[model samples]
Target: MSEKMQLVIDGDSVAFKQSAGFEFRLNLSEFPDLVKAHLAKVKPTANTKSTQACESLGAEVLEKDFEWEFLKPFIRDVCRWGGFALIYAKVLNEK
Candidate 1:
């Protein structure tokens, strides 16, 4: 699907354009800082152990990049629609 979304940043605008080739592009060279600020507003929540809520929200946020703000939402959307799971597993250390 080909779609275009416009985002206003720093009194300027960025055109987010996607094509059928699975290519996504952001055109806002004039205000990268604005983009960064916008992205920072969507930070991930702290790790949790609950199952139900964790699974739901995790699935929503997992497919996104940890640092790249402009690309995280789209990635997360694709992952969720694709039925991908997000896990937060960690090992413990013995003293």
Candidate 2:
């Protein structure tokens, strides 16, 4: 059987699939804030505008054809308790 879980953060949901272990798949299409936060950390000098920074980073990721090594750190950080928990708890508690 396949096991999966989901948590909503900042009005957007991220899914975790369990095969051998949990694998995170983020839906950035719905969570611009998360993406922006990540970009700010990874590319601090790039842009002050969150939207623009996200777009630029998105382009870079796409240009690299979604390299896992390039994306893993960002994904790991965003999924961390300190990063997403408060947001997730707030959204979950509301429902």
In candidate 1, the residue pairs with backbone N, CA or C atoms under 3 Å apart (3 or more residues apart, or in different chains) clash, namely: none
Best by lDDT: 2
Q: Write the per-residue lDDT of candidate 2 for residues 1-95, one digit (tens) a residue.
A: 64655554433546665555676767768577876676567542322234354456557667878786645433333334234534544443453
Model 1 alpha-carbon drift over 4 Å, by segment: 1-27, 47-95
Q: Check candidate 2 and list the clashing pairs.
A: none
Task: Give the TM-score of each candidate.
Answer: 0.22, 0.27
Cα lDDT tens digits, model 1, 4-92, are 64433433334443444344344456366765774566444342222334355555455553444633443444344333424111111
Candidate 2's C-alpha runs over 4 A off are: 1-49, 73-95
- Report per-prediction Cα RMSD to one decimal: 13.4, 13.7
